[model samples]
Target: MASPVDTPRNSPSPSPEPDNPYPVETVLTVPKFKRGWAKGARMAFFEARVPDYTSARAKGPAQTADYLVAVSNAYCQQFTWWLDPPNEPTASDLAKTDDELDPAELQLKAAKILRLRRASRNLLDRLSNSAPAISKMTPAQIKRDPVSSLISAIANGKTHVPRARTAYQLWSKSQFNKDIKTDVDQSVIDNGVDAKSGRIRLVTGSTQQAFQNLPASERRVWELQADAEKAANQEARGLQKKDGVIPAMPLDPTATQDMLDALVHKIDPLLQGISKLTNGNAHFYWAGPEPRRGGQINVISMHAGVDRMPIPCGFMEAGGSEGVARRRTVEAAIGDFALSCYDPKVQAARTLPKIAPCSAPPSFLRYRPTTWDAGNTESPSAHSQPSTDNGLISPPDVSLPGNPTTSSNQSPSATTSKKSSKKRKSNTDAAAPPAKRHATGVRTNTNDEDQTSDDEPEETPWQVDDDGSGEDEPANSQPRRSGTRTSMRISTKTLPPQHDPLDDITNTVHMSSSDKLPSPEIPDNVAGAQLTDDDTMNEGLDTLNAPTTPATASTPVSTAPFLSNPTIPADLPKYLTHVLPKFETLAEPAWQDVTKSFVKYEVSRKFDDVRLQTGNRPAAAVQWSRLRRPLITPDKLPREMPQTVKLAAEAFWRWWRHLQPSWRNVNASANALGDIDRNITEEDWERLDASGANGLVNVMGYLWLWGMKVGVSGEGCQDWEAALRDVQWALEKMTAATNV
Candidate 1:
């Protein structure tokens, strides 16, 4: 219901009143917006007509927002999903105002930059057409927010990722080299090296002396690693040498802030593309010592999944204290990566699934102890074996000459009575093996036991004693060579109680006067104790086998002592009827050296034994000679060896001269000596592979023999003696072609 005054007021136009009224309220009709008006058919037609206008509207701040969401989310995922918090930059890292950075923090920044680079690239690629507004955004600007700041607190941290990695690698590598160099120094220090040359000295003469000496493996590995580290260090040193690049050593902990900053600035871009293939997850480490016992800390995305644990790479012998020694011992015990997968036996018998080619080796394919979580205990140290020091075995007394003959009954000093005492003194002074012979070059034989003898006490020509009763001769005195020979007390055994020579002579006279001393006892203990009945008969049968020593200085001695097993027995004439015409050839000094060396080494004794065992076959005699040569000639003796001892030296010389071409390639030329009944076939060669064939064995044997003949003997070459001792080792590993 309308009021009367209101009724008139209610009309479309209202009138004014004297006291209380105003003008009329108007209602105007306005054009309406259509349903879905902003997105209407007319607007759609306009948008379609002008594609650029629609495109401009679509590419607005909303695209920027989407990009921020995508890039931010990607980086966040990278940080949260990939890196555990411990590996991330911490409050301490953010507080580090100095240019000097914690390696971990630098690593974190590098990882973050990697994430940003990856995310930004991905975003730019995806938003190329519709989200052109994304071009306005940069990871540099976006990383400043609290969320992005969690990954990298410092501004421009994203830019440093690559350089940080390179610097880190360089720093770590430099440190590794330093440690390795220290280890090398320690090795040389603990195990003394030669003063004149740098080769390791033989400190002990145990049967297993090879282990006591610098192990060949350790030497080889250290040499290689040291060379590499030295090269890298030199390169870094070269870089540091650059003017204004660094004010001090690059590795100095307190290097100038500017230098450090410059370093970071210089290095960042170089490593930017390091893991482009692996998405920044392809990192390596070289860790050791406390906190990094498993080796240098690093993270890499392994094939199975992400890895964030310390990885053990190669074993490094700290070679330091008990603790360090324990660590090295442990590393050696369980850490050597013997790739069993490649072994034929293991491959044939394995029940496990095959390893993936893309994944890590078996040594690194297992889970490692992680440092990220709390309550994790450090790995326990390995239990160490008890150690002891035995008398340090060195080479057999090099100061004294070996017995001239294998006959233990005869004193070698007696034979040298006429020689100048100066010759003996010269020989004694030159005790050490000559440098040319002591070369520690690699050899085919690696077995340690055979390198030196511990089985029997070495047979010395005579024992030295300082019984005060016997007056010592002055250094310049014309001392008997025999008396001087026993003056060097080489063995560690305590000397027997001193005796008065007058008392001994009086006692000897009393004993001799009381009873004729039991027909000059022929003790069985002496070498060449007595000629066996068979040996005597053999000698008597070969009446022309006796050796004749020439008076020339080149002759080893004026006469070959009656060593029991001489190739030409004492009773046998030197000129054999089998080859009597060749007797003139035996006059050479080379033959004298060969004959003396053979007698000294007891080779003729061994030759007779082999000849008897292998049958009276003349071919067997030649085979025995081949076997004996290497045994006798590790340090090649000055003389050339005769082909066989069964024949007279002249006869063998004649045969050797005739058969030079046939025996040139020792292995290829000689027929198989031991087990070969037929010619080797192609299949035998294939099966043998690099293990060595009949020909190889023969050639090595021949060369070994030749080396003994020509290699410097006496104290001139210790390596030769070592080689001689290793004959059994060679025979064990490289036997005659058998089971063919």
Candidate 2:
């Protein structure tokens, strides 16, 4: 017997779409300055859209290069020539008119700064006034949930790709898809997708929850239903029996590495990241809302589970609001544009405690708050940067409106934990000591410093422990793991129901009622995680059943190039096995099936049926949510660096080798595992529980974490809160399966 799957688990309990979109989130307002700003950068990234970028069009990419460099410089300087002191007028200082410079010299920076300025008045604006409600996401969910990372096949190639399609059926298995055999893990994939939700669910909690949700917990005796269905689903290659091609099972992963490379890397990046498709304006590599402030000059396109590119922003010109028309004129001439919703810099700047106008900081604070807290430590009056509670280990809110948690309100579903840290010392720099200490465990260091003060008791006095500030709201709770998400167009509908969905714009954890209450003190890098490898990387799952790899040997992902690039992206939290907590690895026999009878794996639609009020999302977001996991087909771990992605693959193998209890890991759908629990009987459940669930949830956590780091953030994949939430959800599902 198998388990149940083939759709999102335990969701679709509808009330009205929660009207209030904006949720409360921690906002770190920083004063940009010269030296220490970049440490915990003050930069704000916006998932926004802008209109005409004619000025930038006049400049173009070739011409945009020189200006882009100038913008980076201008922000750092205080110039009287410009209306604002912080605004660097150096780029334009070189030329009185746009034509004075060589068209070939233009860079994206100049255009990015100039274009976004045209959209905004001042660089320092508070874009996201309210925090948006966002739940944690698994790597799989982020990759598959593309409501914003939409890019269309530009017929004319002049304007931005239009949003022609809305919904797509995404597979949950795609996120952790390690095997590169190409054909969608026909058996495994079919296990999760639901033709109705346009999403695939393989090993899900929905069915189990159906029984678990009964008012009488004792009444919930689980049964093995979906697992057999999936076993039947995985019965054949492509799983095409007399039914012709099944609606759920699609023959995927057939394309050569070359085709994938072309589509995943070249085309996707250029179209969304560097392309001038959106009226010469910049667009996010993935998808989301518009900027709260300054606009985007460069286009960013991101793919799930893989790669990312950085996004740059510029300050709005003084009296920017009044000069909107003129700004557009200039932007259009030079082809400069800003990203939507990013204008938060503008809003935040306005709200930020005005320090000496001369002492502003640099931008990196948007993604990392540790530095922001450091800054506050140095400045007694650090109003710009706010406070957070680090003691509680609150997880992202996974409960959607209709889907009451298993215990209902009896137990809060999520628990918050401090950021995970590798056992190794800070490889980047020495951590700051805690400034003050409390018996209850509260500590504070400067939130305005170059480095975050470690509050971990074991560290030092300079460290500051924080209880994350952001909290999820009741109405528009971030979309839960098992539910569908909604996205609307910005040009026309950007401001429809409310503001951004995430409450705190920056990354921070939220504590819940049920979470283990922390002492007054909390520290950074506290998740004492460990890594265990599966023996199969060097040994064997089966010589015949090996993993797959990219076919085109021409291009390989090199460690050298990645390390050299200042922007070398780290694989998401998944690969960061150094810090995983309570993790006992799940293993598999080395998949020896090198039979790369490649199938072109496009994110197949489970329900080729109608996509309606059913959580219709933007195509851009859908595109960004799907991560590509090319199967590894290697020999004795290639002695030399290959042309394709090497380091990540190597690290993956090394980690695989560390599995604690070598598992002949089957690519079993979640449903199958559930059946093993159910049919086995209560005694079996008890035995399995005692023997250990192998920390399956922990495995999912690492995978989700790795996924986030892989892509340049803002590519719709690097939401830390989402990653944490997904891990918790996975844990709950796994725990339930083991107990039943």
Candidate 3:
């Protein structure tokens, strides 16, 4: 229970009263919250239910981010159960946290909002490109299947995919267009758009680079393209003289980048529905640097549960000299067919149980140290873990009900479970999968080692070091990171020295060039090299066809273990894999109702008298047999399954009602209250009957399944590229099929 102080706290303030009163002025002084006020406000502005995203704007000599100002004032005082101490960045803090800003600082909510916005713009741009070239095209063309349109565009070398575009474009492209002053989208191709005589036209050689795949040069090109596009758009409008033809304008390559992130904000609701559908919330996160790297794009789409963790469904790389060239393709490449949006595969249950790593450029794995808790402990800076296995490294269920300590043998052992259930009858089989992907949003294709190799040194195009000499570092001294912005530097050895001697990377013998000096002696004990010949031979064997290992391994392992990726790979850029996933994790809570429910549950029942008077059952117990169904008999109990089994199965609901002790008096007081209507979605009740691991998995599964139904879904397997097409198809088909 934290209370605020009237005095502004520059450092640690005196502890507040236990009342944890939501004091207006004093609570705002909490140091932990001070840092994130602006960011939180921005998130809340969009997250809070509203008539529209923006508030009414008023003219002002001094403009401010209304959202940020509110957050700084509201959450500034005490630390909430869900929020860690404040790390809010102020204008001055931004100057201090310039280059060294930790990527982790840009939490999930912020990241997701960014992803949503970026993705929306990117999707629109794509649709703009593939729209009917002639504004007055036939209805058939205007209403062509979006997924098919995207596929056709991809197959026919069209510049972009067709997703949901503006209604103006849709109507104008249709034969019905007459006097509507619809503007053509120059960022994307003007497919069926009638060549507006007064508009400017621009040429753009676009590429779909993976969020993590683009080189720095390519990323910069993307940024420049975005800025230039903005400039072009501004100039185009102004170019309209009394009677001139449309100005010729080049397209903005940046407009279609993988920055496909969520522009909208989603806030967690207290006592809100848990395990809601996942569709309308699919978002793409672009990892940010410490100093406010950038925004993410979001969407709602169906995805293979745990399996989706292994595939970067929206990844692509192209046309950049450095950094990442491609922007995230939100729902593209999945062949987003309208009907396919209802694909049975989209309904399957799959959850990695936790945030997992994206298996992209090998370097991204570094952020997820082998220990799931490494660098994530209460005292993150104090813990320095030794790097061990490259294979998945699961952790003890630290977030479980009990204080799951770092020590292992005393962890969630099978022995404790048997002892706890000794008095009760129990039997079980909760199978586990072979390996789990990390919470990070990266996945390397086991079948596509060549994908990593395609951009290798041999086929390499432009050199970051324009001079033939690969010495990219400045002749004088390397530039120090000022804040979040740092110039790109291509490492000489893009791939880690960890390639197996027998794998595709095994072509170890390199021709020593007279121009290039030898690198330092390769360490014999390098992790990749430490493996035995047998291990090297089986290089990708662990991921390619790893057998599913049952979770019933006597001890429950936290599913999303971090990988210790050591260095950046030349072929892969750091931004895509190295930094993006953290943003996703921060955003996860908003997309769902985890934290809010837990916080609310903590404060519930503890003092609520209604709960005391009426325990779990109603005052009078109605025969469950007559009301619902008869309980399983003792004989059947042995065979009956459990809906949920705890691994790290730890969380909560409304606290004010649940924890507080209630009065036993039969007569109710006027002040007596009951926290009713704990949101029970269809997904919830169905999971109620499920026991053990099935419960958690199925709950998450239904959420995702429903999500796809609402967001990204199509009939069959949606490859990364075609998914967006399906989304467009779904939106359009649904829109057209509507009687409106």
Candidate 4:
């Protein structure tokens, strides 16, 4: 017998039919191997099953094409099985009877086996059709057979699963926000895989440019399609979105090659600016969907450290209707600012230097209000004892060495007597228990109201100035003696010297170790006198002194003042800096204006409102004129109105009036224009009413134009111009509708 490859070209076989031309089971010979067969025997068995396609080639080109198609289909079926193999039943599964097993499980198992059988038949069919399975064919065998070589190339080539149909359907349903069925059908034709060549058809430059000129909704369709495509491809390859291996956004037709390259160049500078503003605590990068490649500029923040993680900031798309991109950019910047406030690293960076200074007490030592000040002045003994106010313990009559009460003019005998008397009083106070002192309040008057009235003094409490400037004293020099004995003032006998007492205390407390002061003798009657050490007392006093130098020299006096500052960072992109300020002071109100404008434009443009046409005075315009009469007139514009806003409003009015020649009389009432018969469906009316008012759109439209004018300049100006042109085109369409 001749070898399979050397078989005669005209050998008799079943005639080929138009459909199901190649009978796979009849023509193919399955490879059979015994359990004990060696590797060589198995290899020879597979070689013997290889197909002879010489007979089909001898018939005609038509027959040959049919045969190739059948062979390709068979190979695909076999490859499917190789990708996912069927699971064999285990011993435990075999032990279960039909009744014991779940019907669903049994059905699933049978289905899997059926697929495996089909795969086996196809595997044999490929061998009969001059092509062995890819796994069985050697490199040398593949090169010898053209059919096998083609199959090998196809199997090994990059796998591009045609996901455009799935992607387009999902994208349209979620984001298209228009006639879903119509747009989906259109997208399949425009961006889907070519039927002839199983590959995505490249969009031509002219088609792309035309798409850029389309309406905002239509443009968004293409942009979303590109994003879906990239996401699908990434998922197929098990690639992460942040791998930075982003696919090019071919469907964003507005962003040309030059524009995309410019955006790429801008990334480093933009990120650098953000990093500088955040003090290296935050990092920005392009990521998400097709935004990384200029479909939309998604600026994501990552914590700037070893374990960097993605943070949801905001995104800006390059193309949209007028003011859309600018609005999105400003919103994104604001979102980043807000999110950064809660970020641990960001907050730490902002406050690290100020922590110690802000937390430390004020530099000047002064008396603060205590618990006794809250109308609880009733204790006599508590008032006479050394007060623990502000954590300082000093006897009532104990005066500093330099104080006038302890002046050098006093005789030594008199000073000794005063000191002896002070020691005796201290011993008596120490002998008294704390509980007795707290209980010894003036309870003679039991009436609650009388006690409150007597205790609550009309005059401010007396405060002694530690610096001896007497600035803390009340206007009346003579101290007011209140009926309540528990006044907040220190005894007059223990007045501080005419200088900063803290200075002397700090010197005495922080004295050199070698300069040991003599310890004073304690009386026998004083409790805990033996436990008190002068060194320990001095150490405790040291803590009372305020820090001479702040913990951080560079610490700001105020904390997080940026939270209140209206000014934006100068290092930010010029577009952001220019546009952000306009919305900064009136962000919420401006956003409301933008939303109203969008609704008004959509309603008027869709319904073809004749009142908004160039020749007719719109109701919005008349209302605007009436409203502006007081704030703006021929003589002067309101001072509160910005120059930019005034100029923008004026320019928009001039452009609106002259947009088209006015055949109608200038004196025609806006009410007359509204009276024109027009077919508006119930749904359309609902949509129109849902839009609320129209005047704000006209106001915001002018402001948006002014912002776009100033925000973008140079080469970057083209994008904004294209956006404005879209708005102009929509308005022109509305105008043409009226003429019709």
Q: Residue by residue across 249-302, what tens digits does model 2's lDDT show?
A: 221122111122223232333433343343333322321111211121222232
Regions of model 4 farther than 4 Å from truth: 1-299, 302-706, 710-740
Error of 2 at 410 (Å): 26
Ranking by lDDT: 4, 1, 2, 3
Q: Which stretches of candidate 2 lie over 4 Å from their true place?
A: 1-252, 256-261, 271-472, 475-740
Angstrom error at residue 729, model 4: 20
Tally clashes: model 1: 25
Task: Count clashing residue pairs per candidate.
Answer: 25, 234, 173, 2
Per-residue lDDT tens digits for candidate 4, residues 380-446, read 4332212222112221111221122222221111122211211122212344423211111222111
Q: What are the C-alpha RMSDs, in order, of all predicted structures? A: 40.4, 33.6, 29.7, 35.1
How does model 3 score by TM-score? Answer: 0.19
> What do the candidate models score in CA lDDT, each in turn?
0.25, 0.23, 0.23, 0.29
TM-score of each: 0.14, 0.15, 0.19, 0.14
Q: Which 10 residues in a row give candidate 1 its minimum summed lDDT?
A: 526-535
Residue 59 CA displacement from its true place in model 4, Å = 50
* Candidate 4: residue pairs that collide: 51-127, 51-128
Q: By summed lDDT, which 10 consecutive residues of candidate 2 come out lowest?
A: 594-603
Cα lDDT of model 1 by residue, 59-169, tens digit: 453333223333333333333322322234344444444245455543354334334333443333332223221222255544433333322211212211112223223
Report the error of model 2 at residue 727, Å: 51
lDDT at 133 for candidate 1?
18
lDDT tens per residue, model 3, 527-589: 001000110111122321221211111122221111112231222212211111211232233
